[model samples]
Target: MEHMEQYSITIDGRTLTAWEGQTIMEAAHDAGIYVPHLCYLRGLVPFGSCRVCTVKADGRFVSACTQPVTPKMTIENDSEELLDLRRSLIEMLFVEGNHFCMFCEKSGNCELQAIAYRLGISAPRHDYQFPERRLDASHPDIFLDMNRCILCARCVRASRDLDGKGCFDFVGRGRGRRIAVNAEARLSDTVVDVTDEAIDVCPVGAILKKRVGFKVPIGRRTYDLEPIGSDLEARRRPRAAAPTGGAS
Candidate 1:
């Protein structure tokens, strides 16, 4: 493959080299810089709906997941204003649904919950919409709890792109928009398998596998033990090589 162009960009005052074709979030992650995001799963195409990854690119705010980095671009990711805005977006997601983590099956292992913790959000500031969603346990091995869905579309993208099964897609418009099964009213009427990527890619408890509930204990679940993106933070800004044997 032709070499991807590389150039420097500054995020939150830190300088990091970024490759061409990489979005702001991608470049930040490559440098072990944690840019909070949901609805932007790696491997799948970036869907900038969530807006949690919004950052200022050269003083113009844009969704980092979709905004490609440019040479010498100044991106403001962790500014107080940006953090406050991100927190608001996340809070809205929480309130838009009935996300009762204490009662939800995906509580501890949920990416949405994990991100809330990572961002230090104890509770949402926005009022709950509680849009009167319902459950769809029609599938023999899967549970579709619409109440917890933040509409991140990770399931939609994963099913379409990763599993090669377009079993999930959005239907309706605006507030009425919701996930729909392929050519079916319910999941049981669709072709979704229990092991499908769409089922596994749900960031929240919206789409969950059944029959193995509570398999992960309360205190030992992923994100329960560590903040999300801990792996990337562990490698934060891979140290510049030791200067090749103590200075030239």
Candidate 2:
């Protein structure tokens, strides 16, 4: 059997070696370049819904989380075109979703909110197309706010990969799209365990812990104290090494 290729590539003008099959965002993180992202959950398949981590490679806009690293490829991490696209995506996320920062419990700590601030997005330029959504707080600890969801599908992927339970899936397409529980059951009724890991996997306040809803003041929240990427990187533990004699 042929092995998956591995190669060295350059990102943000920095050269690094990585497996060819690994996504560019994974390679960037390994190199400490800190490309922004929202829908990418580690150990899960890339959903490419958030579009905050779009980068220019070979003169095209592609999601870094889904784009595979090519040997000797040149990646522009913060090019003008890429940054503009990112800003536009962030703005769209702000307006498309029911992200009322002033009233949100994750006002300061949200990944979506932090990336917007990081990119100098003062406020959304377009009109707020507010859509009415029901909040599913029936669960004992997990809160599923459909209005705030960007439909990033991190929760869906996490349910399948890390949790070994495919409880969540995308329900619709395009504008009416949403992440829904399997068989249309409420999240509280799913067979899967709603651990903090699932909550942490969410990039926005769509899913949160009921216990800590109002515990931290908005002024003292996470991103208010540290950058979003910094907090995420801190959570990055080392991957386990491969076995030495693995039938190579």
Number of the predicted model whose lDDT against the real structure is largest: 1
The pairs that clash in candidate 2 are none
- Candidate 2: regions farther than 4 A off: 1-6, 183-185, 217-220, 231-248
lDDT of 2 by residue, 5-88 (tens): 556677777667666467888777765577888887666677787788888887778888888877888898877777788888
- Please, what is the whole-model Cα lDDT of each candidate in the order they appear? 0.83, 0.76
Report the poorest 10 consecutive residues by lDDT, candidate 2.
Answer: 239-248
- Steric clash pairs (candidate 1): none
Q: What is the overall TM-score of model 1 with all chains considered together?
A: 0.93
